[model samples]
Target: MNMLKYPTLLTALCVSTMLLAQKAKPVKQGNKSHTDVATVEYLPEFTREVPAESGSVFKIKNKRYNLEIRLWDQKKVRIVSTVPMGSDTDTLTNDELYKMSGVTLSAFGKRIDLASDEYPENRVAEVTNIQVQGLPAQPAKNRQDANGAEEIVVEGYKTTTKKQQANVGEVTVVGYKKGGTDSSGKTPSAFPNRPVKDEPASIYGTQNPQVADVVVTGYKSTWTRTSSTRRNMVVYIPRDCKLVVDNRYTDIVVNEDLDKAEFTLYRSNLGLRNVNELRVDASFYTMYAGNLGYADLKLASGSLTAGTIDNAQIESTGSEVEYEGGNTLFLKSKADRINVENVGSVGGYKEFGELRIGKLSQDLTLEGKSTHVKIRQITSEVTAIRISTQFADLRLPLKQLTGYDIDFKGDNSTVYSSFEKKEMNANAGIANSESLVAAGVTFGNKAPAAFHVKSDESAGKKTSFNITCNNCTVDFK
Candidate 1:
């Protein structure tokens, strides 16, 4: 039967006529929500033998079928595909399903490629038009005033004058004039008494508060989110066989262990646990992993949540990473946020955003244009921290730290540390950026100037902090 009978299903199933010739049984699927039933059909299996000298490593390249590929301990390469047809159509022949599927499978010389020209209905994605929402306009209110005299005396201030009342008052002007101290003349000051000298403000490090997430008027914000249908395929591959996958719009899950895997994904989803080496090139790459080692990711956006990464090299437009521990991380980004509970070390260059580390056990070397860094605790094991940034803020724990060294060169920047105002320019009492980050409070300075603060903790541990910044603030308290 033509696919028009099932408009929801974009194309026919994949069933060859050769298999339908024997004991053909039309299986029916129960209707769940709508008038739709399905019949399962397994396509012809494709396999290739590995050469004895070629090391039994199968290479798979797939651009179709959002399949779950599991690495298994198999002798050779094998691929199988299944599709569901409308069970109501018994008269529908197998030849029609095979032609509509456009299946293409080739396995030769340790290389296997399985794909199809046509995809199921669920492979299609739907995106809504760009929507713009804005705040409503506010009407202006009319101003009002109470009726009163033009030069009337206020409650506290009354008119004062010395007059010679000898009936010459008609010619001399002295009826009333504004004057007064308070009801009591003992105070020479005005009725307000100068406002009680103003108390000093208590704030350190960043002077700029975190801007709320608000869109101002006259700004047109247009955005859209893409969604995928629930349709997928399943594929089985040999265990630990090196894999190379590419460009598609589907969810890929590598369930078993893999020694090495490389992928180029666009508008796709991927998930894995342990991988010896993984290289990915994607548009919006988002993944969750545990114990992932040796990863190289270059993408437009990266949102990774991992347990530990032994080594990584990431270059992206934006990032939101939260990891437990890592050996070494190197990255470059425009705007990103990186939070590690504990790590051996971290090194990167960020154009904007924030970096937070709960407890660092090793060294931290960073360079940024405008990135606020908040480190909760720099362990004694950490020998040194080197930073360079502008229009940003840095906070460290100095009150809790023992003896340490600090070499700071701030060009038009402010330092808020020492227990006193002059001590804000002092050293060794406060931290770098761990001031109030946990409460969603961030900071930055608008102006900068030349200033330097140094400390010598020659007796305690050999920990040190060296920073050079412009228009920034360093808070150690």
Candidate 2:
């Protein structure tokens, strides 16, 4: 960023004055009118001073003219011509010299600000206040783009200003904002960019109309079911979505538009096997429902919030399973741990039973209507567990869950387990939620003796069940 120098304006005017004088002169053809001009010659001459020389040399039309001229620090003007009509030598008349030097330094001085040079700053006037003084009343004749690439020249002045305000830093910006509309705008948006499929609404009053599309915003998600289970429900988790995973566990987010969400489930010799570890990764998927109902809903790295409507039930069987979507998801029996990384506005219903999680690292949130959630064995390090309710109790093995920091947020809930009864001194806190003890010890605020649990080895190595409450309470018997 450089400043403007006013002296340069004078130098430019010297050339402009000469041009003006040439334009004013009319042509006198042999037998033609004044408009019948033939041609005009513009000869620019420069006089150079040879140091230690008696005088100087003038270069005119590539020819040298020996003459005497004085310069003040190479910034002086000199002119001498043999043509008496346009000469500006000492012997020439005032009118002749003035006409020869048609431009005065003052004229050029007024426009020196436009020069890209370093000099006195703040020379360029505010373009808004300064109008094009010498412009013609009407605009110049319009010019069309011959090759369709329209280009127009814009001429204007620029200025700089500064304002100081309290508590805020000084803001400096260049002001060149004023101009006509753009000659070329961007192309319009395409028509009906794509297609969307229509899905029928559920008639059971427990399900809403199926959504053909699901868009994920930020890739953080939570799959929460509440404290109740009026009946068994199935939620289909899809597979065509993004998955973010670390060492402990993986996250699933099904945020994409699909024509349909369907799956087939296979029944194992047993139910969901607690013997083998399982991992869940989702994108888009179909499921196979064996004897038990399965939900073919895809869980991405987003909030897949669902609650039991009537008595819907859904749980994945630990058997040979395969699913298909835009992208195939191979959710093998290697790991099956779930967590709610973050929460957003989620709308839907999800139900699960016979919980079998291989690992649990992040925070897990469970809430819904008469929903049943059971995590048989959390064989991995636990971060935090939060349980809430329309009506339901979270059941898990206490010995398998170990972490220095464990947070329990539940409401009117109960925890039942059969992994190990050994009590360890672990810091536990509760919030506004109530707690119930059925078959094992419960961790939360309000604890009642009616929910006490008696551990039995016949319940198995990793056997657990939970009775979350909605509007009703039941017994373990």
Candidate 3:
């Protein structure tokens, strides 16, 4: 064989072997080449323009993918994706890829920000002002239903009629009729009549000469008497009227706001779907409300349970008040137990009672005399906490007091926390035999004071706690 022919055959064999090796290699999962070749299709699901004064939110969604672009305070633009992630490229659709790898370019006035998780240096595209459509107008009341059904409009109080049956009695009478002969045609009488009596005793008494069984026809009539009965009707309150509930021995139930004010009191249930303000003053009764825009309540000896009140001014004397949720609460009471949970900005004063707050979203100002207070969770928005009590034991779970400035003043009262003894300042001028002060123990700061407790790094905003007690011991962890 020629040497050139052998060289050409060897070169061809080496090239074929390289191609076979490449084909035998396994492909890695989630490769871009594995994605479906079809282009992504987007359909408009819904567009919502949030009602706000300073900020605006425009949302666009398609199927299971949602892209929300929010302009907060006209200064920042946030693009959020609510689509779930897929395991591999084959499982992920084009919509998912658009959400995961898309960039958001928004401009407000002359300021613009480009935000994206992928391709940070990509060219920015100019965008025009987005035109947002307002919500659809609601139909008027008493209008026909959307499903082509006739709506029955009922106004005023409902009426019900009832009837009563009449009474009846029965009686029997006896009478006689005689058979007569012809008068002038030589007719004789069958039997001659003896006598007829006109007095009552002859008809009903003894010594009767003749007796005969007579058939008497008597008429008996039946009559019906009807009487109308009406129930106690409810008084409809106007929508704009402020609800003033003042009653004794009556329990009131307040349902959700149906753009009206509806209340059930005693035996009457009235609905006024337009009331926005509520004021209640009742004693020896109980009131329950679902939600109120604004409320002013005063109770001498009763209980009030409410779901949420936007703003409230509450006063109670020897009564229980339970507020499940609210924004602002201004409370003043004496000798009563008050429990409020999930509230923001609470300022109150209590005397000779117990107060328990589950969670606070903002600030808290409390001043009490001889009262027990317990707070479960205080958020980062709380800047300062001040408590002044006399002759009462104050217990606060130390876990809730992380990164707070604690100041306590009391006479013959005890203050205790979950912090250890070595984690407190305890070096103030009041740290004598009679007074124990735990102060200047800064948490989350680089330079710590004497006996400083280092809170968890993940704690929220730093707060200051100034507590004052009389004749008491202060302890912290």
Q: How accurate is candidate 1 locally (lDDT)?
A: 0.52
Off by over 4 Å in 3: 1-231, 237-275, 400-402, 418-460, 471-477
Number of backbone collisions per candidate: 21, 79, 24
Query: For model 3, how does the per-residue alpha-carbon lDDT over 1-477 read when each residue is reduced to its tens digit?
Result: 665769889888888999866644322222111111111222222111212222222211111111111112332333333222212235545444444434343445433333332111121111011111121123322112221211111111011111111211111111121212222422121212212221111222322212211111111111111111111111222222223332211222223343322222221212222225666555555656667777777777667777777888888788888878688888898988888888887788878887777887777788888777767777667766677766555555445544654544443443344543222444444323222334544333122223323344456566766676675444443
2 or 3, greater by TM-score: 3
User: Lowest-lDDT window of 10 residues in candidate 3?
Assistant: 223-232
Error of 1 at 416 (Å): 2.4
Model 1 scores worst on lDDT over the 10 consecutive residues at 207-216
Model 2 residue runs over 4 Å out of place are 1-358, 403-446, 449-477
Query: Cα RMSD (Å) between model 1 and the true structure?
Result: 28.3
In candidate 2, position 348 carries an lDDT of: 31
Q: Pick by lDDT: which candidate is best? A: 1
Give each model's whole-structure lDDT: 0.52, 0.25, 0.41
At residue 408, candidate 3 shows an lDDT of 42
How far is 254's C-alpha from truth in model 3 (Å)? 5.7
lDDT of 2 by residue, 45-107 (tens): 322112222122211111011112122333223333322121123454544433432212111
